[model samples]
Every structure is written in structure tokens, then in C-alpha cells.
Target: MVTVAVTAVAAALVMTGCSGGPSSPATDNVAGTPSSGASSTSKSTPTPTPAVVDVTPADGATGVKPTAPVVVKVSSGSLSEVSVKDAQGKAVEGKLANGTWTSKARLAPSTAYTVSVTAAGSDGTPATTTSRFTTLKPAVTATYGILYAGQTVGVGMPASIQFDSAVTTPELRAQVEKLVTVTTSPKTEGHWGWLDNRQLMWRPKDYWQPGTKVTVNAPLTGVQTGDGKWIANDDSASFTVGSSMISTVDIKNHVMTVTRGGQVLRTIPISAGRPGPETETRSGTKVIIRKEGTVIMDSSTIGIKKGEPGYYKIKTQSAMRVTWTGEYLHSAPWSVGSQGSSNVSHGCVNMAPENAAWMYANSKAGDVVKFTGSSRVFQPSEGIGVWQYSYANWVKQSALA
Candidate 1:
């Protein structure tokens, strides 16, 4: 009887545990019922967000030309910020819009640069990226060449430097000026005259001293000028002044005296125009640049009205060089009877053939040719004339001292 009773109670306990019914302790005490440990399920993990990537001007780039337009683009998210910086870490000026950024100016050559970018996703989570790049080495450049250096030529050969391109930067002008150093052999003072932006000329208050040496150097390579321009390469030139030749024309006395190294070579009587209208010759420093055995002298060519008192269509003889508009030191066969006696030619100092040839032989291109008279005011255009104004006045015309 006892075995049957024990078996029955054990069977009942097994049935209670197996059935989907509540346990006796959990059912009896609601607040303190034993909790199922597996009630909390595993939480779903959030998907990993994509990283932002910036493209363009890829990192470690070299031989990159300054002409390359800088541009930056982003992927995987909208761009929040983009910046370009030089090796010095200064932010390069640029613009950004529509997930794209660009720079207006080109980058400098052989320079290292860095770029940083930041982007954000739809969830407002932010991401950042960085890159570095370097430009290619600078190309071989060319510079201006001084054709005639340190040499005293005609005033026509203004100390001129022919540039490869029109200079556009103040820095370039400064650089070019620094390369030019002039010293007068006789210690005469001079200054550089910038005729135009591209053409720079140098001249002394007076003519360059005989035997003076001038040096010109144009070293403009790899120099940065504004607007992506630079000098081409390196060049140098030097020239020396020749013998001392000077001549004085006395329009009042109607004579021209030729000299060499302070020694009077000869004096020839001449004639100048009667003072009236523009025919009167002005007196100042001048230089003879041409000498012709004979030359056509058409009064009409020089604007002298036909039938005018001084107007005559004819060829003049023994014409020595005078660079002014219409003037010469020549033989006046028509006035030979008045040679050394009277002033009879039109604004020119007329002389005999022998005397004119002698002056031509002794004179050089840069030799001083001075004229003196009271008939006309010395103007700047009267031959290669410098006596119209004082040396101080000449210096004032130069853009640089």
C-alpha cells in the first residue's frame, strides 16, 4: 500500500513539471515568482555606416604643374567642408559648392600641398578625410637677353632689354632692375628710363663717357610673377664705349668746329636758316648718326610749301649725318661763294666737301655734336639732343633712379 502511494505522488510531481502550467511557488507568490532567465532576447546590432571619401588631386602626386586647376569631390556623403593648404599650413583660397570645391589660380610648381575634407550622412553622423599632393618640378625657363651691353652706341641704341613677354608684375620689374649695373668709365651719372612697361632704356644725363663699360644681366628663371608668368632663362651682355669725338656747331657764328680727345681737328664755315617760322634751328647737345656723300633734299618732303621762299626740289651734296627731323652738315655748292663768309642754308650748317668728309671720318655714332645759337629755343627733338634740359631734368623723366 505504501509503495503504491509513493509512486502516485512522484508521478503527480513529474506531470506538473511537464505540463505548460505555472509552477507552484511562482503561481502562489505573484510578486516573487521566479523569472525566466531567457526572457531577454539578443538585441539587433545597428548596421555600420559607410566612410566618406574625398577624390581629386590624389595624394603623393608629383610633377604636378601649377597650371592644374584644383578641384575636390566627395563620395558616400554630402561634403560639409573642404580645404587646401600649402606646405606651410596656410589655407589656400578656394571655393566650395554642391559637394565640389575648386581653386581659381594655379598652384605653384615644386610645392607640397594638403587637402582636408569633412562630410555627413543622412543620420547626421560626421566623417572626415585628408590627402597630400606635390607639384612637379619647374620646367627649364628662358630669360631676356641684352643684345648690346656695356657699349656706347648711337643714342638710337638706348640701353634696351628685349623681354620674351610683356612683364605683368612689379616683382619682375624689380628683379630685372637689380640685374642691371652700370658704371661710367669716366664716372658719369646715369639712370634707367622705362619708355614703356616692356621697354627699359638707360642713358646718362650726358652721353656715356668714352671707353665706359656697361654690364647687363637678365636672370629670370623660376621666378613667380603674378598671373602664372615667369622669365624665360638666363642671359648676359656687355659693351665698351669707343673713342672720344666731339663737335660744336655755332649757328650764330655759322661755323662747326670738330675735335677729338680735346684737340681741335678743323673748323668749317657754315650757314643756318634766317630766323622765321619753324625753319630756325635750335641749339643743344646733338649727335651725328649718318653721313651721306649725297642725299635727296626735297623741300616738299619736309613740309615746306611749294613756292615758299626756302622751298626747292633738288639734291644736296656732301651731306653729313644729322639725326634730327630735317637737318644736315653738308656742302652747299649753291652757296660755295658765301662759304666761311655768310649763313645762307636752311637750318643746316653747310660746309665744303673736304671739310665735311674730314668731320665724317673723325666722328663716331655716339660722339657729342653740340649746337649753339639764339635764333631758336632748344627743343628735346632737335637731333639726339640732350641739352634742351639740364641733367636733373633728364633724370626726372626716368621711372627708376
Candidate 2:
């Protein structure tokens, strides 16, 4: 039995050596250590960079001011191109640097603007983005109609500005007042007056020198009016002063004298307003606003209705408008004989057709028209009557004063 047991133990040992007994579960490499075996599936694909872009105002925004700041940027990519345009398709000037874009181009008021951009990912994948917005159009806005280029005007042409909305606050008015400046080649002293909240006019203390160059700069973008309105954009004009053409109309003598550079050009017989409230011509320093070959004269337009005394409508030629209250230097053929002898008809400087034509052709807008010898005083609201106020008095009209 001992011999048999020994033989069996020897046999078991040989069998154990021939085949491994129980196999333990295959062990994984320690965490973060390299693995000997490779991945079973095909080599895994690498992750790609994300494509992204952004623009200010998002898209489809409204009530944007022309001066609103703009920005464009991209992430995980580089910006390739960007463009901005207006409703008229004019390009807004911009600059791109340091992976960003910016612009200072002035925009049209109450206009729509668009922006388009392109970008490239790290892997060269192209991506595109776009945005559109509209500029603010205030229900009330300011209008600048006095200053314009190329027209030779008189020294008395005030920078007449009117607003659809009233500006009553002093600070608000000051904000607008500073944005407007008049620079002359010779450099002249001037002052601005608020003719009420809605109108502001600038004029020199003395008449402008003949041949002076005046530049009117009105940068109103983002400027706030006193009453919930802001300036939409900017406007500028340059004008050259022509010869000094001034006319002195004497209501007593019933005569008109035109002068240039202190020399008399023409002295003609003229018929002024008859003695009355509605018929009296304003007697103060005034500027010739504009001229017309023929303007239909209407007394009712001046609040002198039909059946009222001295109410007659007549068509006249060679008309030069001097005041807003229906006063003009026009040709009156029917009153030619009485022109130099008497004050008759309505509130107009009536002269012979020949004289009227000569004056109209020679005179430029801004010419000085001084009406004296009458009790009538020009109101600041009546046409370009800025000369009605003295320099000191005019200074008092400014909010900044």
C-alpha cells in the first residue's frame, strides 16, 4: 500500500506540471500604465475643433443708432472675412485685427444695415454667419436747411436749424449746442441763440467779411434733444461769402437803395406797406432768404382774409423773400407810378419791373435788407431776422450763457 501511494503522488505532480491548475482572471495593467495589447477596433478617430462665431445686436434688431458700437468674433477658429453694408448697398468702413472687427463709418438715419462674416476652423473647415439691424428713426428730428455748399450767400446767413421736437432743458440744449461749430478760413466770432426750444440759429456779432469761407459742422449723431429725441447722424456744409450787397428801404421816402462794398448800385422808387397793422412792413435788419422769378401773392396767407381791409391777391414777378410774414421785394407794374411817391398796396417793396429784375438778378441769398422809417420791428421768428438782436442781447439767448 505504501508503494502504491508513492506512485500516485508522483503521477499527480507530473500532471500538475504538464497543465496549469485553475487559471486566475487576466489582470489589467495598473491605472495609467502602458498596456501591452492594442485596441481591437480600428484606430479611434481624433476629435475635431468646434466651429463658432458671434455678432453684436444678434440679428433682426431695430432702433439702433448710427453710432452704435459693433463687434464680431469667433472661437476655435480664425475670422477670414467680414462685411457691413447699408440699404443703398454702400459698404461701411471697418477694420479687422487681433481676431476682432470694428467700424466707425457713419450710418444713414432711419436706415437698415447688414453684416456678413466668414471664419475658418483649426482644420480649415469654413463657417459663415450674418446679422442685420435697422437704425433709429426718431419721430422728431432736427432739420438743417440754412447752410449749404457752393451757394454764395451774404454775411448774415445764420446757421438756421429747426427741430421737429422741442428742446426745453438747458443741459439738453447745451449738448446740441456744442456739437455745432462754425469754422471760418479767417476765423470769425459768432454766437448761437435758441429762438425757442425748436429752433437754434448761429450768427456773427458783425457782418461776415466779403469772400470769407465758412464751414458749418453739425455732428449730431447720438445727441439727445430735450424731449426724448436724439440726433441720428451728422451734416456739414461749406459756403463762400460773395460781395456785400445791402439795401436800405425807407418807408418814408418810398425809395430803395442797393449798395455793394459801401457803393450805391441802384436807387429806385419803391412803394412800401400802407399805414396799418397787417399792411405795415417789418422795419429791422433782415437777410434775403431766397428769390423767385414769379410768386403768387396772397393776402389771406398772412391771416388777412378776404373782406379784410387791404386784402388783395396778386401774382408778381422778380420776388425776393425777406420775411416769413409775406414781405418781398417784387415788381408791381400796377403801382409803378406810385412807387417812389407813396406807400400803397400791401407789405412789399414795390418797384418798377426793370428795377426789380435788376435787383433780383444781382442779389444773392443772405443779402442785407434794412427796412427803416417805420414803427414796425422785426421779430426774431420772422424769417432770417437774426440781425434784430444785438451781440450782447443775442448771447443771452444761449442756454450755455
Candidate 3:
């Protein structure tokens, strides 16, 4: 009995030894048995690596103007995600190109912006980075103004203002018009006429009151015109109108009377056309073309041959103003004795220099310069002075209403 007991104990010890300690499980049944949970747990599982991403326009950059384009780039695996935000953190609209993103429109000035991006690695791990930037401050400046002021009656004297820069906004027009103030003797009501985007004209529906005072104030110190340009600084000018100085020239009588406020200033002796080469001056209103201290009268320039019987040439002196083609109210010293007495000039209203000066001093741009006593009324042509047309007819010539 003692020997059998000992044998059983030895067998038990051997079985325990054959079971491969803790490392082996069901080793004897490896040919067909499934592995226990302990066996499967022995094999380790791998954890995926995280991905890294980078975005452009890094954090805290400033002095950025809206005119500049916003660009963003990503790194690491790829641009798996990207976004831009305003100061309020609202997502701004943008477009993605390749691994980069961009905004089509400019950003607002003096604003803060943020950019975020995410990139994933092959291991399915995502990394993100954010950047901040600020926009540039706004610029404030002023601009200059142009003035066209004169008082030639008959539509020739229009108050024109031309802006050096193009006005992109209509509001600018109103701002400019506010600077204009007209003080006419006969109180007139008128509005601005925009000739184009850059030019404006101010005129009454009719001619200005005979003796009106027109003033222009252009305070375009820092206004923005357009195309990144501002009005010029230190620009201003003014002009004045004299009393009502209206003149009437009768071609048949060959006389011109200067009047002021219904009072005749002078009755200058004059000579009118003999009517062969359309010497008749238009009978409508007229404006002075220009003033010259002296001018040389050449008949050839007016389609008159130098040696033609009707053509004559002479040097004129004290020529105050010439208002028509081949016509001048100049000092005819040679004919001074005959002036105011007989029609002896070649169609010019010959007058003393003093008389011409008086006319010049009293006349403003819009003052009526009327001519009568012509069989054929004055018709407007390109060569004729601007005043040769009726007020209604002159308005029709303007592109603007």
C-alpha cells in the first residue's frame, strides 16, 4: 500500500511539470484546438501615430491691408481641413486650391483674422495649427478742385468743374456741388449738369441774371476722387460779374450802342458788311472770343485772297476783344476821325481804345452781345463765337440735359 501511494504522488508531479508553466496554454492540443483568451492577449496591438498640420498667416501678424490677398497652406499628410475666421470668429468664405486655400475678396481693414488647418497622418492621427493676423489701418486724405467760371452770355460762359480723378461713387458728386454758391444780381435758380463722370457744369435754364454774382468754393482738401487718387490740396479761385452791360449792333445802321442798366454808355461809330462774301454778322447774342492788346488783321485767313479787291490787311491796335470771325472792335487810329460818323471799316465795329476798354471792363461772360440790322439773321456755325446761337439752341448742343 505504501508503494502504490508513492507512485500516485510521483505521477501527479510529472503531469504538473509537463504543462509549460504560465507561458503555454493548451500546447498539447495545438493541432486543432482554438487558443484561449490568455494566448490571444499575449500578442500586442499597435496604436496609430497622430497626424500633424500647419497653416499659413501665422499668429499675431498685422499691418495687413484688405487689398492684399489672404493665402493659407497646410503641411503634414495633407490639407484635411482648413478654415478662416473674422474677428468675430465667423467662418469666412474661401476657396481651396491643391493643399492651399485663398480668399477671393479682400479682408476688411483694421480687423483681426484667424486661420485653422488640420492634416491627418497615414496612421489616422490628425494635428491642427492656428494663426492670427491683423489688417492695416484706414487712410484719410483730401483732394483738389477745378473751376471754370466766366460770364459770357449766350451759353459760352458755363461754370464747369473737372475732377482730376474719376469719382467712383455718386455721393462724391453731391459733396462737390455743395461747395458751389452763385449770387446773381437777378437771383436765378439752377442745378448741376453732369457732363460725364469727371466733369460737371452749373447753369441756369436761361442766361444768368444780367448782373449776377457767381462764387465757387471748392473745399476739396482731403476728398478721395477715384483710382487711388485724392483731390489736390490748396486749390481755389473766384470771379465776378459787372453791371448789366448789354450791347446792340445794327449792321444796316452800322452802329453799336453800349448800354448799362437801360442807360446808353456810348454810341460807337461802326462799319458793317457790304454783303458780298457773307459779310453779314449773325443777329443773335454773341460772346467775346478773346481779348488782345493788339492783333494783325489778315484777310487771307478768312478765305480772302491777299490781292483780292475786297481783301485788305492792316495791323490793329488797342484791340480789346474779338468776338467773331474776321471781326474786331479795335482802335482804328487811321479811321478814328471817321468813326461814330460814317461806315468806313471793312465790317468791324471800329471804336476808340478807351471805348473798347470800357466794354471789356463792364462785360462779363454771360452778358448779352446782340447784333441787329442784318438781312440774314446770325446762324450758329463752328467758326462763329459761342454767343451766335439762341439760348434754346445752345442747350440742345450740350450732351447733358
- For all predictions, the C-alpha RMSD in Å is 18.2, 15.0, 19.2
How far off is residue 321 in model 2, in Å?
Answer: 0.9
The global Cα lDDT (0 to 1) of model 1 is 0.62
In candidate 2, which residue ranges exceed 4 Å CA deviation? 1-137, 140-143, 146-148, 162-172, 222-233, 307-309
> What are the per-residue Cα lDDT tens digits for candidate 2 across 1-401?
00000011112221222224544345444678554433333344344565577777568889877557667777777888989888778787788889988876556568788888877766766667678988778766655444446688987787666776677688888977877887887878889888778778888889999988888777776676744466665778888888998899999999888999999989999999988887888799988988877999987887778998767789999999998788999999999879889998688999899999999899889999999999978898788767888899999998789
- Per-residue lDDT of model 3, residues 64-174, tens digit only: 655456676544345576677786776666788886677764465557887776666545455666778886554533333545344334333545566654566666666
Query: Which candidate has the highest lDDT of all?
Result: 2
lDDT of each: 0.62, 0.79, 0.57
Instruction: State model 3's lDDT.
Output: 0.57
User: How displaced is residue 118 in candidate 3, in Å?
Assistant: 24
Off by over 4 Å in 1: 1-188, 194-201, 205-207, 216-238, 305-309
State the lDDT of candidate 1 residue by residue for 1-401, as single tens digits.
00000011112222222335655663655786664433333444344345446555777777666657677765545667778888777566678777677876556566788877776654446666777888766443324656555444543233556565555656556656665665445666677655444655566766666667766655443454435554424566777777667788887777778777779888887777657666776667766655676788788878877988768776776676665577777766677666666666666777776776776666555566787875566555444444444667756545455
> TM-score for all predictions?
0.52, 0.69, 0.46
Clashing residue pairs for model 2: none
Model 1 lDDT at residue 247: 81
Cα distance off (Å), candidate 2, residue 399: 3.8
Q: Which candidate is the best by TM-score?
A: 2
Q: How do the candidates rank by lDDT, highest first?
A: 2, 1, 3
